[model samples]
Target: MEYKYNKNEKTAYQKGYRVTKEGIVIGKKKNPVGWLHTNGYRRFKIRDHEGKNRNVGVHRLQAYQKYGEKLYQEGYMVRHLDNDCTNNHYDNIDIGTASQNAHDVESERRKERAIHASSFIKKHNHEEVKAFHEKYGSYKKTMEHFNISSKGTLSYILNKES
Candidate 1:
């Protein structure tokens, strides 16, 4: 079955719990307190206010706590500045559009590619790579010759596509 997004109020009601600004989830009625359990991604289970158990990313919770409720809305996403999901500190979390988040991820990938390319260039001269490409007449063959794993980086170096 498809899962639903965690609604703060709804989850609190269904789980008989209330999450405080301090990131403490207190249960109500006969439910237990401090029942915050993390999934591998540091998400916690909450029976949504609709009575459906759902896992909420802790970073979102932390953002909610720090920025007040309603921090997340449709088309909005929570981003980790250090790209570490587990680091849910208030200062580390912020809101951004889905595209902005995607750009951040792409920027990180570009940085990695640049690093790999620099190392590859240091190991093999530009003339050598150009000759290898010319001899093979195939980007894939040139990549195989250079043992380069990122095709994007290879394209950037050979085709000047960035």
Candidate 2:
């Protein structure tokens, strides 16, 4: 995964078109490019050898500037340590395998799912579910009485109350 920069890119890098510690790309004049991709990563417009404008991720540029080509060798990618795509700060970035990056994203997704499930569960009457379970002394009967679809949901509601 070693990235070979074209002449234009190399020239830009040499001319002070560099990413800062904050993940902003600073041009030769020392002004921020201030452009961001829709996916939340900062982007820089660099002209290719063909003179066509191409967008590059600021994190990639930062990784290259900091760690050089060694970071990209053998399928390694730039990773956000805090799982924040927009936080391109030098200390918040790392070089890792695709699986490591995927694991970070998956961990974030699991947290989001848990938060959503917790909020959804709060919309239900936990006290009523607990009382009904106690009265029936059976999870199946309590779920049936509450019209709950998942036994796990019933268990969660009953257990969460305690």
Candidate number with greatest lDDT: 2
Of candidate 2, the 10-residue stretch with the lowest lDDT total is 1-10
Instruction: Give model 2's TM-score versus the native structure.
Output: 0.59
Best by TM-score: 2
Error of 1 at 126 (Å): 20
Alpha-carbon shift of residue 135 in model 1 (angstroms):
29
Question: Which pairs clash in model 2?
Answer: none
Q: Which runs of model 1 end up more than 4 angstroms from their true locations?
A: 1-10, 13-40, 68-70, 103-108, 111-162
List, residue by residue over 3-45, the lDDT tens digit for candidate 2. Answer: 6544343545765788778778898788888577787887778
lDDT of 1 by residue, 1-162 (tens): 322454554444444544454444445654434333444345556665456767666666666655554454666677876666556566667887765664555676866765677465754465577778878888889888888766566665665423
RMSD value for candidate 2 = 10.2
Name the regions of candidate 2 deviating beyond 4 angstroms.
1-11, 106-108, 111-162
Error of 2 at 137 (Å): 40
RMSD of each: 8.4, 10.2
